[model samples]
Structure formats: C-alpha cells, structure tokens
Target: MRATTEEDATARAAVVARGCSSPIRTATGVWVRCGSRIKSKCESCAELYRNDWAAIARSGVFDGPVTEFRFYLLTLTAPSFGRVHRVPRDGGQRVGACSCGVEHSATDAGLRGVPIDGDMYDYAGQVAWNRDAGLLWDRTRRRMRDRWDSLEYFIVREWQDRGVLHVHAIIRVARFEAPTPGVLRDAALSATAVSQVDAGVLVEWGEQARCDAFRADGDGAKTIWYLSKALNYVLKDVATASVDAPIDVWRHQVALGDAARRMRCARDCQPQDCMNLVHKRYGSRSQVVSASRRTRNRTGWSFTGLTRTVQRRLRREWWESRMRDEAGDDAPALSPPPLEDLAARSRRELIARGWSAP
Candidate 1:
C-alpha cells in the first residue's frame, strides 16, 4: 500500500473497484510485488525480509558502536501447555523426527509447528502463550534495565521444540558491566510470573532459560545474525499458523485440524479478541518480531535500500555525468553527498528515482 499523510476519500471507491492484484510497476521501472513475509505467498519478498532483518540485527550490534556496552544472547522459552508435533534436538543433532509418519525435510513448512494429535493439542492455551510471550520478554528486559540505563535489543519469536512459542533475543546493556549467567537466569525466572492468559491459565516460561554472554571481540554480530534465522520460515505453514484468523477458522484449522497452526493469539480465543486485549492493555499492535525504541533510532537503521549510501551516491553521479554529455560542455558539476543520516539520504535517492509518497 502507498504511504499517505491522509485518506483520499474521493478515490476510495475507485481504488476498491481496482481490487487486489500482483505487484505494480513503479516509475523507476521496478516491479513492486506483494510484500508478503510468508514464503508461500512470495519467496522473493521473504528473501527480502531475511536480508533486511539480518542487516537490521547486524546493525543493532555494531552500527551505533555499542562497544561501550556488553551484549548477551538470551533465550526465554514458553512453558509447555500440552504435547504437539515437535522436532527433537540434542546438541544441534536431530534427536528424532515427530511422531507423525512422514519424512520431514528442513524446508518442509507443512511438517513443522503442527500437533502430533490435533484432538489433544491445547490450541486455546497455545494462542494465549503466544499472546503474552512478548510481555514476559519485556518484563525481563525491564529487569535488565535496572542494571544499565542504555539498553537495546531485538527479539524474534519462533515455534519451538514443541508446538509452543519461545523468544530468542539479542540483549545489549550499556556501561560494559556484564552480569553472570546465573544472575541473568534469575532475572528471567522472576519475569516468568506473567499474567494469566485465561480464567485458570497462568502464563509462565519453561524450565529451560539460557543467557550466554556474547564475546567482546566479534561474537556479538554472530549472536545477532543467529537470531535472524526465523525471518524466513515456511511461508505456507506460517500462514496456516497465523494468529489473525477468526475464531472458527483458527479453531478448525489450527486447534483441531491437521494443518500447521502457527497464527497469532490463542485457540480458545479468537484473533480479534486477543488483539483487543493486547491493544487495550499495552497500547501496542501484535507483531512477530520487534525492536525497542533505542534500537530503532540507530543511525543507519532505516537505510534498507538495495545499495549502500556511498554506492547510491556513486550511481547518481554516474547518471549525472552521462546526462551532462548529452548537454554539451556547460553541464554543472555533480553535487557533494548530502550531510545527513544514511536513512535520510536513501529516502532522497528513492525520490530521485521517481518514488513518490502517497
């Protein structure tokens, strides 16, 4: 959708008449296809997601020179509500596949994040866990902030060993005072006292919580890059697991049906219900992956175009020189690079290439 300052009410009828279709071509002769993060809907867009988020995670590590701070790889897992289809893992080796009678490949979206027995799967509970997992994570981070003022992090939610949800985060604390693993574990444990998801359903983290200190040298980048893996998952499977579906759709497809149910919210609760709860309480929208305010304000954080800043300037100059040749010798010299943040410069470059704000 086009980014606009306000609604063009007059065009609403015409726009609706056009309906949804494939990606549209821009003035730059580039085809802007459907930007679905789900791989099933659009593989190219998913790849774009992987590249963009990977850079974002990487930038969160080294971009702002978080050198004064120490980084940690923290994992907060969800407590098991019930047994579902799971890919067992031990020491990075497959312990065994799911009980489901099928050979599952690494890229098999259909086989992952599903219940071994749909009838027995706690679909409603699972949805509740997904809803509160982010809050639990925030509580843990707030506890961490008590130790340092300048804290920055990015978290990724993944469907884990069981059909449950867990969080993987890249936590950075300022002042270079790294806490021991035990202390970090204790902080996480205290945060696990998350609010109730239902009448009798209290949300909690699983027994296994890990906090590994990132190496001061270069491991910080590696840790962040590691967590970015979830940005590109089985598109179809994740869509099937969507948390935004209606009650009947979510229950039949995710809670009771054999299809992989990975969508947002709880099985007992409908998507709209869960969304309203989250918005009312937290004043925030639901999202799979998210970053803190400080993390988002990094210098180059928003420069996610195809080329880097210098490369874009060079390309612009090359184009200008060619245009000058056509105008005989009186063409003006190429202007110097703008003295602004990379993101701002990139936005100008996009506009120069014929991108207009709606």
Candidate 2:
C-alpha cells in the first residue's frame, strides 16, 4: 500500500495488490521451495520430483496397459576398466575388499561409484563411454526389433557401482515371444560390437548386463511400481554428493555434473543422458522430475492414449494416495496457491485506473 499528498488531492491512498516481498508463511512457518532434484539441496522438491516420475512410470505412458502387454527389465552396463569400491551385497562375499583398502559399508554413498585405484581408472574411457552411451542404446533398440514386432521401452542411465554409466530399461512387447535372458543379453552385446569408439577399438557393455522378463502373472500395478522403484533409485543416486569424500569416491559425481553442463542438446542425446535431459527440461533454478524424449518418441513402445489432463490427474491422485499412506488420511493437506495468483504483478496492472499519479 502507498499513500501520497498531492496538490490536486489531499492525501490519496492506493492499495496495491502485490505479492509479499517476504517469503510466504505456512503452518510450518515461512518456507521457500528451492525446487531441486537433489534431496540434499531441497528435500521437498526432490520428493515431489521423485513422486512425479513414479506417477509417470505407473501411468503406463511407455510400459502400456499392464494387462495387455508383458514387460522386460533390461540392464546394459558399461565395461569396467579396473577394480573399484563395490559394496558387496553378500557382505564382501563377492570381493573381500576394494583395492582401496577401505571396507565400504553397505549404505555408503561415497563408495558406490568411485574407483578403488584412481590412477589406474580410465577417466578417458569413462568420458568416451558417457558421450557415446546413447548411440550404444540406439543400436540395442534397433537390434531388439528382430525379436518383437512392436516394442515400447523406457531407459534411464545412472553411474554404476564402478563410476561408469549403465542403463536400466523397461521393455514391453505385445506378442510375448518370451526369449531367454541370454538371447536379449547376446543381442545387446552384439549391438556394442557396432560401436566405433576408436578406429580400432570397440566399446562393450559391462559383464553385468542383464535381461530379465517381469513375472508373467504379476499384478499390473506392482510390476509397474517395481520399474518405478528402479527409476527412483537411479534419480536419488544421481543427486548431488558431498564434496568431502575422497577424489575417487566422488569422481564420477563430478563428471556427471560437468556432462550436464556441457550436454544441452536433447536431440543430440538419447534416454541415457538423464542429467542433461533434466537440466534442459527445468532450468538450473527449478529442478523437477522428467523423462527422456526416447521414452516419449514413436521409436519405442506406445501406450493407450490418455488425455493430458487425465494423466496429470492420475499423477496427482497417485501422489495423494502415497501421502495418505505415509501420513494417514487425516494428515493436513498443504496446497500452495497457484503460481500466477501468488506472483507479483506489474504496477500498471495493479493500478485500478491503468495509470498512477506522477
């Protein structure tokens, strides 16, 4: 509100409808949402983003009608250059200790994507792999056509336990040829043979490449939920890391951040570049969940069409249900005001007469 004493008017006052200069207050007090995908940067927004992705995954945009189509989960990993800190699932049954001498805890975030020996770790190879990962997947998709007439796939890339990027994809085929796991794996490996990393060299998927079909008889929602869970894990794992960790521990983390900065062209990349796609979708200031063009494009599996509004509503419903489950149905619902209403308006727009006294 503003007031002034003018020669023509004895004390004119104006009530300006403008956003509060200060942050908005809620039941929890004044809160500012950073809207970051990284949980450490902003927990609320990251959770929201994660929920949005889960909603999209379960929405069947790529996976299709659960009852009508059978889905396959395929993981194509990058080849390893050397030993790295790997938190053994069986408590060091696989490998006694990472050559780094540190027995990484099962839950240690720092240990997952770091090289045990940084000096010997192939940073050049790692960068090359990241750059061409999309191409590799393109080949794999082309080859998979031989097995199924129609296919829908959603692929996400994440830095593996060894700091190399790997893809986790959900493939849906209508006919259900039901190829053995080895068949799909062999096809993916064969696709890698076509990759021309160097004139004389070929890039290959890591030995850990896996191709497994979802249980034929499982509930539709459950199967989709499981894929969504894999997606959520990838999103969370790619979130920003603590800088205090050792160089090897956080090396790939740094590379990922750098790649995101450099790779801005969506058309240049496939579904593998999650970080870059994310940055392009939402600018640096705002980070929301997003899927890749590869998933949405006609090249992959298609789903029964749903209206945009319906899709959004379904996502919202899923989020609400998740919230209810976690906090109970009686929990307080905090619905923020629409952004347009809350945002500040221009002075001319706020003024009733379309003009203000000089």
Candidate 3:
C-alpha cells in the first residue's frame, strides 16, 4: 500500500499476501525476479512478504535465543527548582511537591498543580534523533561496555509510541565470566558511564532523561513486557510526553509507575527474559534465523515494529489518509476500525482472525 490509506490497508494486505507467493527463495534469485520488469510477484509471494513482516512485528524477539540480562531506564533533567508532580494521572488531579523540605499531596480540585517551566530540554530534537535512535543507543552501549571487565554481546533497541521512546536491550555478560551484580548494575557506572557516553552523543532525550535498570521475567503473553526491565519507565515515559504537550493528561502515572516497578522487579525474578545473551556488539552485520524450534523462531523483527508507538502511528496515518481519500472521492465518512486492530495483524490475517471490522 503506497500510504496505508483508508481506501484499503487491510484489503491491500490481503491482496498482497494472497497474490505474491512463489516459494520465495531467500537466495539472490528471489530479489532479481521481484525487482526485474520481466518477473512478476504472485499473490502468494506478496502474502509471504507481508506475513513475514507481520510475523516479525508480532514476534518481539530477536533471531537467536533471548539473553537474560539487566537494563536501566534513563532520563536527563534540567536544573529547575520547583514542586514537581511525582505521579500525575489521567482524569485525575495534578499533584506537585514543593522544594521547601516538605512534601504535600492534595487533590487539586481545580487541577492546577502541574507546571510548565519552559526549561525542559528540547524534546522535538530528541524525537528526531530517536528516528535513528537505535544507532545512537548502539554507540552508547559500546561506550558503556568498554568500562566493563568481561566483554559480552549487547543489543539495544528503541521502541516509540505516542511520542514516548523506551529503550529495550539485551546485554550479555560473558558466560562463566559474569560481573558482580553491583558492578553490572553499578550506580556509579550508571552515572559515569551514561554521562561519558551521552556527552559524546548529542541527544536531548526530550526535556530530561532518566535512567533506571531493568531485568526480564516472564511466562505471560506480554510477559516479555518487562516492568523491572523498564526501571523508572512510568515517570520517564509520562514526563517526556508532558514536556511536549500543550495540555497533558499525565494522570496515568500511577498505573505506569506500577508497571515500571514490576518490570524492574522482573529483571531478577525471571531467568528467561531476553531472546539470548548478547556477545559481540553489532558492527555493520546482520544474521538470519530460520523458523526452526531449535534455532530462531518468529520473534524476529515483527514483534518489535509493533511496539505501541510505531503501531499507533501506522494506524493514525492510515486513518487520516483514509479520511482524506473519502472526502476526495465524495464518499460519505464511514467510521473506520481502530488502528490498533489493524496494527496487530496484516490485513489478510486480520480478516482471517475475524479481527477485521472494516
């Protein structure tokens, strides 16, 4: 689909999927045929390609076994002196604390507690950097790894949704050569290493960046959604949105906080959290995993691209585009299905699963 327009993202997916199969050779022949004018893609070929993407977006794991390691949440704040809202809620009161050595909580009946100081870091710039954020984070990881005693592979990824970016990573501490937990999760390293790396890298990380450590735990469907691994996820996620918004409904902080704490706690609780322990840092290289049980499974790229932000944006863009097309074609406005439903599946599979409500 050229632009995921409303005219038919689902239908487009269905058509592409059903029409484009040709036993896609992972070999060079497939590329040559698909790209050449002499060759044409059948429905099965298209479906295979689209389904591959769907599978990756939905899989959420890397090509290899998941690594079980700890990660930290990061945030950088400007020096401002004022009462801050520790936990803001949606459809809830805006609570702020005073720096006068006293903490007070009152239900802001008028909802006037949250403040806009304008000193917050440049968020727009950070989001732009986040576009290539995966790379920036990679560089940061290298810097941090250098300080470690034992070398291991590390993978860092950025997940963005609704303008919020969360850093998910798989850090491998060398087998039988593990660093002490204090050293691995060292607060000093959290400060020094992060600062050193951040200094070399230029990212605004929206007003400020906060870093907290995460460890993975699971057995649940969204079990991969590590809360402890999200260390400090709630506040940072919410705060970043606040700085960029004209009006913030940061009322979900409580729920988010609970989730973040859980993710952090999970780091130590679950042993099978990551896809696999990383060894060597990535360097202009890529790996291929087959859909074999003993080897890499479906959790390739599919599960990742589906992170709430990317999925939401895909949906929103499609909806707006669809609306525009409707107006242009003089078609009456029809209530479109939620973009989320669309994001969760390729158009064909979605229709098959009966999640399609178009």
Candidate 4:
C-alpha cells in the first residue's frame, strides 16, 4: 500500500511538471492553468507558449508549397547609444580589445553590455527608439512589399543586454520575385521612418544588419529552429535586475529604468499621470513576437490556420476532456462561464485576498 501511494505521488508530480501546479479557479469553479509565458513565473505554461509559437513558425516554413517561396532570415539592430564593452560569451573566442583599451576575457560577463561611459550614454534616445521600434518595422515591411510584392514575415523582438530591442524576422517571398540576400539587406537597412509622435525624430535601423537567404527545402528548417529558440528571450522583462549583478551592471539598469520612467510614451503623455506599462518596461510598448496577418491579397505568415487563439481553445478543450476522463460521472460542465463573469469574480476574489483589482 505504501509503494502504491508513493507511485501515485510520483505520477502526480510528473503531471504537475507538464501542467500548472497552482491552477486558478474560474467563475465556473473550474480550474485552469495560469497561462503565463514567463518561464520564471510558470515553467509548464511557458513551455506550452514556446511550443505553440514554434509549431506556428514551423508551419509557415514546412506546411506550404516548398519550392515556390524563398526564405530569408533577417536581423536588424538598434542604433548605438554609446560605446559598450564587447565581452564574449563563456568559452567564446575574444574578438579584440574593447574601447577601454583592455582585452576583456569571456569571464568578464558583468561588463558585457554596460556602457563604457554611463554619463555619455544616450539613455533617453535608447528608450525613445524602443518606443518607436514597432512603427519603424511597419514602415520597413511596407517598403519591402513595395519592392517585392509577395513578402510575408514573422518577426521576433529581443532585448539586447543593454536594455534595447532588436528584431529578428523570417521573411518569405515568391521565388521568382526574391532578391539576392545582399540587395535585400541593403534595402531593409536603408528603409527609415519618421516618428509619428515626435515630428523631427527619424527612426532607422543600425548600420549592422544581416539578411541571409536559404532554400525552403534545405536550410529553411534550420533557420526556423534558430528563430523559434529566440522565443525564450521574448517574455523576459528588461527591468528585472539580478541579485548578483555587478555594481556597474546594476547602475546601468537603474539609469535605463529612470530614463524610461521620465520619458514621454506619446506626445501628449504626462510622465506622472500616465499609467502606461511602457514606462515600466524600458519604453517598449510593442508585442515581443508577431507575424503578418492573413489578408484578402496576401497569404499570412503561417501556412496553417494556427494562431494563439486557436492554440488556447485547443488547450482548453484538451484540459476539459482530460478532466472528464479522470472524474467520470462527477466531472463539472466543460463550457466556461462568460468572460465578464469570470473577470468580475476574479477581481472580487483578489480584493478579498488583500490584492487590488486592475
């Protein structure tokens, strides 16, 4: 009997590792996974989020007509705010001496992204660039489509260690219309947009950009894998500071946060009165990951009709079915209560538990 109990406990533990350990009780009194994409918050749900997007990304590459489309992986970086340390990753070969006139070893990780001169760093400009990155991308896509009419893309925005955003995009274009990687890179790098909020501000990609073309049948799968792995970086909060962070690193983050707090998110934004989350997120307001949408004229980024909404619905149905199987005749109704009712109940529950409602 003890052995049976131990086995049962082990099985439950395994199940929890794959699903939510602390499930939320909804208005219908049905338990649901707390769908957080941050791995630090919920490993199980984060894995699910990663997998769903990975599958969607793969579908865009493998599900459609293979030979008819050309695939390219493009990386765009933000303009430099200031000179920074160029410490290599652990076990990585040292590139060269840094601007500080010292050859930093790979072990010098603390100084990796810290500005060489913090006072001289353009923190305000960096945050403003983050705020306008989405608009810049919108302009970039429009420019690309103007030249190559059959372009569709999936883009992921990643935070550089210095607390700025850079973009990685998987681009697909009709085979006949696709340009050489160099031409594409030049065109994309040259494209610029003026900020709608700040009339005089010109938003542009950094000089360092890459566009590499790969055959959809050959290196395409590998490219998709590379991009999918970057999803891990998407949900991380740039403002989160490490407990063991070096003094310089900590100071850098503090400066960036301070700049973000005081910066206007919009032309009419009042820094004190504004409750915009961008102020707290290093001035970044755009979604971390997104793909072009299906339209009347263009095929969307995904070849399959797979989307986050569809994935969520499927997960809900699967969870309900599993519950029914486990509970047999005692299972609750599978249908969820109205969203408004659930939200209201959740708010009340939070308030009763000494937490403020949104």
**Top TM-score hit:** 4
Q: Per-prediction RMSD in angstroms?
A: 10.5, 11.5, 17.8, 5.5
Q: Write the per-residue lDDT of candidate 2 for residues 258-317, one digit (tens) a residue.
A: 544454334454435444444332112211122333343453332443333354456446
Candidate 4 lDDT by residue in tens digits, 90-188: 766867999999899977887888999999999999998999999999989998999999898988889888889999999999989989999888889
TM-score for candidate 4, please give it. Answer: 0.85
What is the TM-score (0 to 1) of candidate 2? 0.58
Candidate 4 global CA lDDT score: 0.79
Error of 4 at 7 (Å): 23
User: Model 1 — TM-score against the truth?
Assistant: 0.58
Q: In candidate 2, which residue pairs get closer than 3 Å at backbone N, Cα or C atoms, i.e. clash?
A: 77-206, 151-301, 152-301
Over 75-165, each residue of candidate 3 has an lDDT whose tens digit, in order, gives: 3222222333344345645445543333334432122333233234233333333333344444545555566433332222332223234
- How do all models score by TM-score? 0.58, 0.58, 0.33, 0.85
Please state the error at residue 81 of candidate 4 in Å: 0.5
How do these models rank on lDDT, best leading? 4, 1, 2, 3
Give a tens-digit lDDT track for model 1, residues 1-358: 2343123322331232122233433443332333455665556655655665666676666655466667777787776655454443334545355667654555444434555555776655655566666666777777776775566667777755334566777776655666776687677677654444344545577888888877646686567657766645422353345555434334434442222122333436454434343423111223556666523444222223222334435544664565457546874442332221233324435545544222
lDDT of residue 71 for candidate 4: 89
